[model samples]
Target: MNDECDFCRIVAGEKSAHVLYEDERTVAVLDQHPAVTGHSLVVPRSHEEEVLTIDEATTTAVFETLRCVADALETALDPDGFSVFHTSGPLVGTVEHAHVHLVPRFADDDVTLSLSRDRLDPDDAAELTARVRDAL
Candidate 1:
């Protein structure tokens, strides 16, 4: 466990969090500062600063836990929809440990999670897609 990481401390039981589920690979917990009423966080037990650095097995476990958490939130909160996302980098990560956020969304919640409407040139889009596919 990473002593300097808050999430690692939570996983190690050194800090307190409203943990919903915990297994060998991941832990699902309630977000202390929720975006909506049912916001929760799914964190991998092994410390990693970002998704790109986490191994594939742990990533899969985290996502599976995310699905379970989302389903539970839907049943409990009855939100119109929900958002599942992860933040990376120093500017947006807030916490250094990699974690997925499951935020319940209502129709009138006034929260916006839309992509920019700006259109990219077709060639640029195709090139970008090809680059991503090649990288994969």
Candidate 2:
């Protein structure tokens, strides 16, 4: 286990977390500094720096656990919506582990969508859909 990584420490049972869900492949814990109430982190059991490093089985397990946590969050908090994001760039200060942020948003919440003038056109949207579909 990686001693310096917080998530790794949590998985090793060396640290405490408000864990809502846990399986052989993943663990879901409530965020200490949550943007909104019920915010949580879905993390893989295996330590990996980025999503690209996680194998297919571990990736699938992460999302499966995420879906379960999202459902429970919706039922418990009844948030307006939710956002699932993974930090990709070095500037984001992500830990050397593959994890997903499951943040619940309320109707009057402070969260804002960052959009730009260079938005996708209709053709681009169709192509994007096709590309994403092809991946599945």
Candidate 3:
């Protein structure tokens, strides 16, 4: 583990974090500065500088853990929806380890989407979904 990384500190129990879930491969914890009430972070136990740097096994494990935590968050918080995102830039204020952000959204909350009043057509959405699935 990198001694300078915040995630490393948390994983080492050298820092305080509101942990949600943990396993051999990953850990989920509440975000200190939450975008929503139930905003949380999902990270791998191993320290990797970026998502692309993680091994295939670790990457798969991280995503699987994320899905489980997301389901639990939906059931527990009952948010209107949620978003999962990851940042990989070293200068973007992202920690030096790969992680996913799970931000719960409420209908009346401040979190807003970039999409305007014009909605995507169902066919377009279907095509996009197909492309994403193909990529995966």
Candidate 4:
């Protein structure tokens, strides 16, 4: 664990977080600055800077924790739906630790998650897909 990282502190029992769940590999916590009520974060115990850098086992555990948190939010809050996703880099990854957000959504809430952008042309889409598959 990186001693300088906040999430590392949280995982190491050196910090305070409203922990929701914890297994050997992952921990779920309430977001200190929530976008909506019941918003939670699924974090890997190991301090990987990004989701893709974590091992498969940790990744699986993180996502499994996400699912579990979603279910709990649904059961506890009975929201209209959910907004579950992960973010990295400086733009949205303020925490620096790789984690997934499980947000309980209500129909009346103003929280917006939408993407509107120009669609790729068919040829461009096909080329990108081919390149991605080749890279994989």
lDDT by residue (89-134, candidate 2, tens digit) is 6898657777899999888988765646786699989999999999
lDDT (CA) for every model shown? 0.89, 0.88, 0.87, 0.89
**Candidate 3 ranges with C-alpha deviation above 4 Å:** 113-136
TM, every model: 0.91, 0.84, 0.79, 0.93
For model 3, residues 61-95, the per-residue Cα lDDT tens digits are 88898889889999999988888888778656557
Model 3 residue 74 CA deviation in Å:
0.9
Which digits, one per residue and each the tens of the lDDT, describe model 4 over residues 42-132?
A: 8899988899788999998999888888888888999999998888789875678898888898989889888898977999999999999
Clashing pairs in 3: none
Q: Whole-model lDDT for model 2 versus the true structure?
A: 0.88
Deviation of model 1 at 18, angstroms = 0.6
TM-score winner between candidates 2 and 4:
4
**Candidate 1 lDDT, 3-102, residue by residue in tens:** 8988999999999999998899999999998877888999999988887779999999999999888888888989998888888897775788899988
Candidate no. 1 TM-score:
0.91
> Per-residue lDDT for 19 in model 2?
95
Residue 24 alpha-carbon offset, candidate 3, angstroms:
0.5
- Regions of model 1 farther than 4 Å from truth: none
Following a full C-alpha superposition, what root-mean-square deviation does model 1 have from the true structure?
1.4
For residue 117, give model 3's deviation from the true position in Å: 13
